[model samples]
Target: MQPPLPGPAMILHRRVVLSAALAAPPLAAPTLAQAPAPTEAPRTLPARLLPVPRSVSAELQHRIAAPYPANWDHIPPDTAGWRALQAASAAEVDPLLPGLIEALRITVTPTTIAGVPAFDIAPRDMRPDRQGRLLVHLHGGGYVLYPGRAGAGEAMLMAGFAGFRCLSVDYRMPPDHPFPAALDDAIAAWRAVTAQHDPRRLGLFGSSAGGGLLLATLLRARAEGLPPPAAIAPGTPWCDLAGEGDSVNANAYVDNVLVSRTGWLGAAAALYAAGRDLRDPLLSPVNGDLSGFPPAILTSGTRDLLLSDTVRAHRRLRRAGVVADLQVLEGQSHAQFLDPTVPEAREAFNEIGDFLARYLGT
Candidate 1:
């Protein structure tokens, strides 16, 4: 088995061991167990996340601080997990996934969408009663996640709850296929849908970094004079590639897991940008003109580190005269929406459908 990427605790422990060995007294009696040390752990929460409004429940907060949830298999999008996530999205996670999903009784289909000559997944035919809305999802991993599966269980629920076609775009990822590649694929997929279906029948969607790109895509579409989709619902979007948003530093420790929000993600932004300014309005939709963008329904969890990014973007949309619906889930994180098995995840998907049903059907 591949060694798992060290989460916070493991990385911190390794750092401690390294620091202690450097500070060791030359004459001190010590065995291998007597590790060295670094500066004392801070006695209080960092000052950044404090200013942002937080609605996380005490219980949920406790759970997030614990090791990865038993229900959520959140492996890092390092090398192997990326490959696995890719394979799972192409087929299903684990060869046994079909059997497990069958046990849950969800329906899935391996089908191609109209525009892009690439692979994507759909799941709606099997569960008749679950049908409602369709959603086009863009998975987020700083454009580098391998096997970027959006998870079958969650995809099925989002389609059922969201009330329309949910086309999850498997855009070309990065360190390989950069900026315009992914954006072009998204636009093509959207055009394919609009060609046969009404632009008003569509609802664009994504989470985390995916959420940010959803906004970016719309901006680009408007600039290119492409037809605008009916509505958009981006959850906890990572829109600010330049790390100019205050939360990038403020939510640092409190957000956990996502260490140095500005570093690797920033680098990824540059790589995907293909030498574009990190803050270019086209790249950072947060800075783009959203005045005529479609009505939007955005979701964010209180404990999510990107809480500010979502809210800030919503506020901008309101200023732009674009109708915006912002929902802050009491206790959740960035990818909480992908954990459909959880009540919170289920509720998030249901709300997404509710928003689309209201806007698109109008």
Candidate 2:
């Protein structure tokens, strides 16, 4: 009787604890089917909203910021707390740049280019068998953040593929400089490399702002009666600042990083122009006449905010009777070819090789 009387309180406490435990289940294992697919960011090209192609280097249907991410996984994390992240990412990225360049099997030399100024020239390793073609490259990163080293690695890699020498320019950057500074340096680099060389041996290449500069350089050269390049390849060029493209508004939410809106480019353009109109033909390049520009190969990704820029540029070159080849990748980012680690980038570079091979030779 004493045992039974004492048990009720303890029994009730035990029952209560058991009931609470049963109410919540242990964590379940994720299903095999839930495994994430290898992420492939799609290049954004909303067919319904694509801008009408204009006669001037294809005008953007709308200005876009950066291309957008389709999902949270694809999007970059909060930049607010990512300085360390950015630095670390840059650390990882920087090494690869050099490694890629060194791996190019190029033997750099001091060789003068034709049509370029009487300045220095840096020769990259290229097969003598494919000796005639040359690459004049402009590096990207708005106009402030990057240097010629910015894209030299990509150039070296591409040089191997195209069997051409890269005369990459280490142009002056912002703060100490502005708009025409980079353009001037780029043209000088081109001229320096082309000195004593033939125009038929020349090619022009750039990405992002550098790509836009390639167009501007061509326009300036044509205006000044400089020798024409055999071909031009502007990859994912950012050629506008009036913010007049469909992607600018439509892609606002999806693009994760800097854009035509508040991104780094607007600032770069301002500093580059030293307060000049961003739409100035020398500033935007898209505003320049397409006539007498050399044949071109324009490449862009579906998600690239600059896809419209590439499209517009290609279409304009075509309308002007310039030989233009436009390649649109399914899921690519800006200048994906510059990133050989990415599968899409490798694929893009391979395609670029084919394009350059055809244009430079035939």
Candidate 3:
């Protein structure tokens, strides 16, 4: 007989339990003395009977088969575990800086925007039409990691591929400052950039937490009576910090990077939010008013844990009468569009470039 379907409350309860378990510290590894003895080999299942999808790319399949830490949710924010992750990110990213700079044909100059620390990424040969156009990039790490130069990768990709002048915000995160810190930095950066460039020729974009922050920053700008950018791109945004979205449950372990809402990202959200309600428009931009917001282009993968968030944001933007476009890539995971080797990644950015070119006056 087929298994009975679960009730809504039971499903929610199970998710909550899974999230809580993920947030707890991992159990100690088994020593050789306590390890289980070898057992008789079992018969292997046929390939045709396997549940895996065949449509996914070989690159992604290899990634799926690789071993990764399963207890990342247990890592405390601002602690050694978190720092280790940050250090690993630095090791991986720092080496690529020179190559990225050369490959993208962009120069990175240290500067301060609106009194917030930032890097100006400009094409070596600036196009006359792009002189007035600017794109502010907020790097993503769930607001708890990828500090310093490590956060500049997304900005580098945009500047290189999209042929736009980009400013990457190295926003502050916890261990020093928390919620409102990143937001404050983004606003200041916007003010600083807009002070010199025409706001009408400006745009904003970021992935994951950065994407969510882009929306939060725009909402704050509206409240402050500041002019909005010509257009915006919130890529695979972490829109519902409260973890209320459907993909958070449906795509859980299926999403390779973000395995579950109750994982590191969720823990990071709790840390960044401090004691605030997650559903606050500033915290969860999906719940915010998008009326009179700027034109937007959102992107996500079919397997993204935040796919629902992207979909919801796009629907909301359209419902509010804002011009919005949604691009859902096939057989990819969260933020896989950043991969340099993927053709779809190139196409995604090219489409974004075209969108910005149309809206931001070329």
Candidate 4:
């Protein structure tokens, strides 16, 4: 008297369906208020300076100095005094050559890469897979400092740790040759490398001014429709030749190396720019189009005055959809990546090797 068992049609009919629909509450309709807010573009903030590390090598810590002299950049270019200063600077590092050679365990062979004077630094026991792979190094000295074997330290460490053949470009610099001179020599080296091996098998790397030049050279390569190298490592690059960046001001005297943009660093850029527009993309890769650039690995230290340059370049590369990696060491300063005695420096080179191996298969 449960009324006659519901008939088959009643059990499976529109009535049953309607009853269920009525029993359940209706879903709310989506509206603008319920939708997610659109994501806003990320903005950069001024970075706070970090305290120098207590664990830094005493040798490095001792070398730190008061802010550079106010008159460091006062000398005019191409003058006898300027020439003398450059010479003296070169002389300072000359004694360190033997030690650098020993620490890196590289054999130096004089050679010409693309008609540019360069030195080939080969590791004693390179990995078999890295046999034909090569790295072309541009030394950093603003644009008028380290020259000759004195500039080979970075390349030596790279060759030693990365197990790749390295050619350190001994490109001419200001007072004698400037601007396009360094760029031209870099390109020549690139052409030479490409002639002997596939461009995809090569890597370009440098620090500070040399790092900036590596980026500039890449811009030139793209403009000329040349094949880009497999990867590049620009360590704390002075990418903004115009001297634009928050760290340029924030880290001023805080960074012992390249102490200030208003000092010798500025003068060196002026000598290299030689009256060219600082905003010129060739001089400041930051202002250039980086869309099609090869994968890049950028290294810097928290205390480096050029930390802004490295960060900006990494951000730009990401915005352009290019593959890029940035590694910032705690409490180190400008170009500290070249110090083999520093554990951070050795790790930096290994990180670069891993990046290149992924791209170049060596």
Candidate topping lDDT: 3
**Candidate 2: misplaced stretches above 4 Å?**
1-94, 108-125, 256-260
Between candidates 3 and 4, the lDDT winner: 3
Q: Give the TM-score of candidate 3.
A: 0.82
Model 3 misplaced regions, further than 4 Å: 1-71, 77-80, 127-129
Error of 1 at 322 (Å): 1.0
Tens digits of per-residue lDDT, candidate 4, 1-362, equal 12246666756666645555565546243234432455653344566744445766654554443354456546654557667777877798888877777777878887887778898899888889787788889999888877677777788888888877899999988777889999999998887778778888888999999989999999998887778899889989889988788898877767777767887788788888999999898999998899988899999987788999999999999999999999997667788777777676778899998898778744
Query: Model 2 residue 197 lDDT?
Result: 68
Please write out the lDDT profile of model 3 over residues 1-362, one tens digit for every residue.
12256566777677655655655546344234432455644335343421346566666555545443466466664567666776676787888789878988989987788777788898888877667788999988788778878888888888888888998999888646778999999998887778787888999999999999999999999998888999999999988899898888877767777778777787888878988999999999999999998899999998888999999999999999999999998767789888866667778999888888889964
lDDT of each structure?
0.65, 0.62, 0.83, 0.81
Model 3, residue 264: displacement in angstroms?
A: 1.0
Off by over 4 Å in 4: 1-52, 55-78
Q: After superposition, how far is residue 238 of candidate 4 from its true place, in Å?
A: 0.9
Candidate with the larger TM-score of 2 and 4:
4
Candidate 1, residues 67-98, lDDT tens digits: the string is 53232324435555545544544454446556
lDDT of 1: 0.65
Per-residue lDDT of 185-217 in model 2, one digit per residue for the tens? 666765555565687777888788778888888
